[model samples]
Target: MFRNRQEAGRRLAAALASFRKERPVILALPRGGVPVASEVADSLGAPLDLVLVRKIGVPGQPEFAMGAVAEGAPLVTLRNEPVVHALGIADSDFEAVRDRELIEIERRRRAYLGDRPRVDVAGRVAILVDDGIATGMTMRAAGRATALQRPSRVVVAAPVASSEIAADLRREFDKVVCLEECDDLFAIGVHYADFSQVGDEDVRRILSHHATVAG
Candidate 1:
């Protein structure tokens, strides 16, 4: 297995080596996806950007994501009714958590992207890259939001993902590419050796590095 995000990204880049000539755009789902996406972008010589989305977590158990939020056009919210009911999460609680997450999403967009107008996606192939997928809520949100931009194809690429969620996501996107799929995928970190928290500052630093390289 890949040791860390960089190693995983390198392996993933090799798997996707054929895409280089097509010059597809890579949109990373920050703040964790930035590092991995950077490596993919460098390997493929493609421009990198961010697809902003927020996790709509259940109240109290903040890590349990029931859905997600994204800016631009109609916001995408994927509801797992069975999970919500089983978890006893009320509609009010979901709405409250969604509001909070949306606020943070806006702050992230402002802080990380600032004045860098979002690149147009119409007729372009938008590859949504994430470090890994557990609940798949955030990636679903990214896919839905990218749908609004009317991209020719939306590809979901991750180093690892829960098999069930990957199958679910396959129905929504043109292609779902995952390096590893496990049935017992309880957490995204379980598959990584150095699964550290990626901070906003780290994202900013990587973005800056990308900018310098582009310039």
Candidate 2:
């Protein structure tokens, strides 16, 4: 098991060392992703940014994601069509949840980033970082939203992910960097010794530190 988010971030940074010259922007999916992306930005001397994405949970089973919404001018939403159809989820109901997630996304963006201008990913590589992937719905939304920004390439990086989910992510991102992919993946915490819940304050602190360093 990995020691903690910091250790995971350092290892992930090493795996992505080749991209230092490319100067890829590190877009973290907060609040867990902030610490991981902070290390990457520091190691690569790249700008740190947020790519907020929220999962659309099934009505009764909140852990089972039916879709997700990603931040953008025109928000990006990815639906797990088969699951929705199987559950007989109405479009109206789905739209309602998506709209709620959009509000949360905006709230997080402001909380974590304040009024900082978003980093332009146009014609540059955009690396999306998260602590880990479970169902992969959130990252799928993030990738689609990032793609709309016209980045030259989109790379998804995480410390660990479900082997099956990683394969699905490969189709969405230009590259997927996952250190460990296990078939028996249960919870992301299972792979880390200190998988504490990351809070909004922690995210803000990390972003502040990055800004100070960049300045």
Candidate 3:
């Protein structure tokens, strides 16, 4: 098991050392991802940014993701049609949840980012970082959304993830970098000894630190 997010980040940075020359931008999924991405950005001497995406959970079963929405200039949404159809989720119902998530996304963007101009991903390799992946819905949505920015390539990097999910992500991202992939992965926290909850303040602090370092 990884010691913590910092250790995981350092290991992940080592694995991605070859990309230092490419100068890829590190786009982290906020809250948990910020801490991990902070170390990566510093190690690679790359600009740090966010790929805000939220999973649209199934009604009554919030753990079951039906789709995900990514915040951007126009926003990007990806739905699992099979899951939605099988569950008989109506358009109105789906819209309601998506709308709610959008609001939360705006709130987070404001809280964590404020008015900072987003890093340009155009023609540059965009590396998406997170603590781990389970269903892979959030990362998938974030990838598709980042694609809209016309990055030269999209790479998803994480410390731990399910082997099956990592394979699935390969189709969406140009490259997937996962330090530990377990077929029988249970929870993301299981791999981290200190998987404490990451708060907005923590995210803000990390981002601020990266910004200062980059400058």
| Residue pair clashes in candidate 1 | none
**What's model 2's lDDT at 77?**
83
lDDT of each: 0.84, 0.90, 0.91
lDDT of 2 by residue, 63-106 (tens): 78999999887888889999999999999989998888878887
Model 1 alpha-carbon drift over 4 Å, by segment? 212-215
How does candidate 3 score on lDDT? 0.91
Which 10-residue span in candidate 3 carries the lowest summed lDDT?
A: 206-215
Provide the clash count, candidate 3: 0
lDDT of model 2, residue 42:
91
Selected candidate, larger TM-score, 1 vs 3 = 3
Q: Candidate 3, residues 1-215: lDDT per residue as tens digits?
A: 88999999999999998999997999999878888998999999999999989999998887788999999767888788999999999999998999999999999989989998889899999999999998888999899899999999999999999999999999767999999999987789989999999999999888888876452
Select the stronger candidate by lDDT from 2 and 3. 3
Give the per-residue lDDT digits (tens) of candidate 1, residues 54-147. 8887777778777788776777777767779898888888888888888888999889989875667778778889999988888998988998
How many Å off is the CA of 64 in candidate 1? Answer: 1.2
Q: What does the lDDT read for residue 195 in candidate 1?
A: 84
Candidate number with greatest lDDT: 3
